[model samples]
Target: MDKILETDGERLLVAVRNLLEAKGLVTTAEITERRAITDAANPGQGARMVAKAWTDPAYRVAMLSDGAKAAEALGIPMRGMPPLGVLENTAELHNLVVCTLCSCYPRAVLGYPPFWFKSAAYRARAVRDPRGLLAEWGTHLPEAMKLRVVDSTADYRWMVLPMRPAGTEGWSEEKLASIVREGDMIGVTIPAA
Candidate 1:
């Protein structure tokens, strides 16, 4: 019989879960439930938050100061995890999230990151050649625009609050949220007007 093998990351994840389960720290049922929670959290959550920020002055302030609290206010469950820092992209600057060491992210907001985000090539180039990388990703900023590459560590997960596109004023929150996709919140792309 040919035995299928798991990838390095899968193996490591299983090992860690096993270690915790053996120590009575966490059970398989709890792990399964957490996985369910993460799976349900897609980029739409981020988009809704962005839409709220675009329309509501008070919620925007709360989200910027306390991302987790703001998310909780919207019924998004976030606990026992590192703080989720919301980075606002303005006309003068752009913000990008990358984990130089590992794939740390706000899973409760952005769901599982894209496959490319976990690649070593992307991790290295996000800091070394951000402009080139963004261009390749179809996000061309103005010449010499200020770009901030935020590293998402285990202590803090970063998400981008993309600037509201022009001509989107007076739009409903659902409409605005529809246009803001996952990559936009990740700062690799801009939402269409």
Candidate 2:
């Protein structure tokens, strides 16, 4: 695999620059710089929605029912024809999302997909027994939270907006985002902090 991916950096850069120049693009350097900035700014966009749901009940309900609309209500746009669905982790049911057929990620809300999430091993095992799979990931939940597995197919991707953790009565958005792990958003675990 390493050999397969071997490349000359200078050649790659020249190719990219040539492509951009051929497209009659202006300020390629500025465009690349802006892309980096936008990527950094985009990852935390969903944190605002999570914080709002933690503070507001109506929004939470809406989020559980209509994930896309709930995000739109919070001013998050869903582009590229990607369908969004929300899975709620409740006291009696812990929801987990898996795309056994293909990786159907909620990139709009969760930014880039994790390496494990894109693996076939996780996708296959998660569907078989989500509780065991989550346990393997070190997310040990109490027996009270019944395990419920959800499948996100190629047509529709899902994201888990976890329940607000205990002792977060008045926590700020930054604090909340700090505890919101990638696994939590992927529905494999809930935020503890």
Candidate 3:
């Protein structure tokens, strides 16, 4: 009997993409159109809320108290999904985001959650020992700072829009966004040069 070999899921996805591209079916227009639809469906309205909160203390309070209302106030639509809660990273307590069961992301605000965020390693270890897991991802929070691991579930999904690092007071939003890496947004790393 011949033995069957299994391949990784990522390899399988790459194979599918390659197959589609081989047939000249995946054009730039097709990609752009699909992206446009996705963007329309899940806009960057949430990111605006994060920017506002970073600048305004009152808005930050509002976001922490009532995320749905705050997001709506900022023109972000939160329909057909649970009201997302935003966790701001502070010097005292670092916030980490994860979806333990499924990938329930805040698409309207943060665009799309990264693939690694949906990985079993991140999901499982985030809940089990967040500090150690974060360390593996190159984030070393101070001993005094408490680690608050948030779970993204059906009823509510969360995202961490970390505070802008100190030395960037005069930086523009576009410049700020440049430093907001995937890991920083996920709370596994801090914003630093």
Candidate 4:
């Protein structure tokens, strides 16, 4: 029989999982179920939250206060996940999120982090030259606008609440959500109607 080689990380993960299962702390089925849930998560869940916040004043207040609870209220499963912080972009201020140390993303809400989000260059540029980075992504802010780069950590994750486009005032929540892309929530691009 041919041997199937496992990398060191994979081997360690298997060892830990076996130990956990042996101790009755978790089951393989539970792990599979959780992985399925995580795999099913997507940016649409976050966009829905953003859309609801834009149209509902109470939800906006809730989201701005506690993002994780706000997401749970919207039927997004946030259990066992780090606290999520929603950064709002205003006329004079823009918020950008980056995991400076590693790819610590809000996967429970926004699904997996994009490849670019996990890059060392992005992490560095997001802090060292945010305006330039945004501009490169076709997000040109006014010179006077304040750009704030927030770091996402294993303890806390972040998402952006982008400003609603001017012409989308009368649009429904579903319509608004359609325009809220992953990059919009990442603050690399603005949502446009």
Candidate 5:
């Protein structure tokens, strides 16, 4: 049989997993089931929460108060995951999220973090020159608006609740959800209606 090479990180992961299984701490079936649940999560789950918050005041309050619970209420699994925090953007304040040390993201809601999100350049620019970073992504905010950059860490994750675009009034939840892109939830871009 041909030899299959693996990176050190990959080898370490395999070793740890094997040890865990050997010790009966976790089973392969359980691991596969958990992986499947995480794999099934997508940006759409976050969009649904944003849409519901846009149309429902109660939901908006709930989402802002407890993001993980709000997601659970919407049938998105949050168990065994770090606590999720929702950053609400307003007319006067804009929120941006970045994992400065690592790519710690709300995977349960936003699925996987984008490649750029994990880049050292992005991590640095987001904190050092947020406005410039936003401009590069075609997201320009007014001069008077305050830009707040929040960091996601292993202990906690964050997602943005972007402001509902104008002219989207009276739109249904599904319609609103359709316009919410992953970038919007990541605070890299604003949703356009």
Candidate 6:
């Protein structure tokens, strides 16, 4: 394996994979390929896409209409992955993404799911009282703004297109992306200008 199974949890996963491969239920090549796909994706890709959307109106339209194609346009691979859906955060609407069934995160775009993201509390409350949850996360939205919680599932993955922060009018795309963290893509926080 290219990844060192240093942690106990990682060693356990290796053991499981080995057993599955030994039984012919799966293969080492398959596991490695999947890992490669997941490993190649990181928050940087998502940030670049978001920054581009913020700077280019045409790309923003494509991003809002077809996130997968938008990602591909920026050379982010989407093969064998679920469709990527970009949810725009506007003045009247704040968007949140969660996977109630399990941690069906957009790992290809946002890397691993955060510890809190996979927690049962976050999964439940995000769908139940998202405003309260966002408040606790330090994203206190105005009471009048509508909060929409979209579910990330096995077939479709969702990510937030956070509103561009103020005071960055002439900033470069790289500068803009620098402030767009993984949490911002997940809608738990907003990027600073």
Best candidate (score: lDDT): 5
Q: Which stretches of candidate 5 lie over 4 Å from their true place?
A: 1-26
- Cα lDDT, all candidates: 0.89, 0.76, 0.73, 0.92, 0.92, 0.89
Residue 155: error of model 5 in Å?
2.5
Worst 10 residues of 6 by lDDT: 1-10
What's the TM for model 6?
0.86
Candidate 6 structure lDDT: 0.89
Residue 83, candidate 1: alpha-carbon lDDT: 88
lDDT of 3 by residue, 166-186 (tens): 887866655565666556666
lDDT of 1 by residue, 23-134 (tens): 9999999988978877898899989999999999999999999898989888888877578889999989999999989988777888888898899988999999999999
Sort by lDDT, best first.
5, 4, 6, 1, 2, 3
Query: Where is model 2 poorest over a 10-residue stretch in terms of lDDT?
Result: 37-46
Query: Residue 36 error for model 4, in Å?
Result: 0.7
**Position 135, candidate 2: lDDT:** 82
Give Cα distance to truth, residue 77, candidate 3, Å. 3.1
List candidate 4 stretches off by more than 4 Å: 1-28
- Model 1 accuracy (lDDT, Cα): 0.89
Q: Which is superior by lDDT, 2 or 4?
A: 4
* lDDT (10s digit) by residue, model 6, range 1-193: 6465555897788788888988999998887897887787899999999999999999999999988899989998887878888999999988899999999888768888889999999999999989889888788989898888998766889999999999999999999999999989988898886
Model 2, which residues run further than 4 Å from truth?
Answer: 1-43
* Candidate 2 C-alpha lDDT tens digits along 74-140: 6776645467777777777778888887777777777767788889889889978677788877888
Weakest 10 consecutive residues of candidate 1 by summed lDDT? 1-10
Assess every candidate by TM-score.
Answer: 0.85, 0.75, 0.70, 0.86, 0.87, 0.86
**Which residue pairs show backbone clashes in model 3?**
46-109
As a TM-score, model 2 comes out at: 0.75
**lDDT per residue (tens digit) for residues 1-193 in model 5:** 2344344678878988999999999999999998898789999999999999999999999999999999999999988988999999999999999999989988899998889899998999998999999998988899999999997756878999999999998999999999998889989999999
Candidate 1 ranges beyond 4 A from true positions:
1-28
RMSD of each: 4.2, 4.2, 6.1, 3.9, 3.8, 5.2
Pick by lDDT: 1 or 5, better one:
5
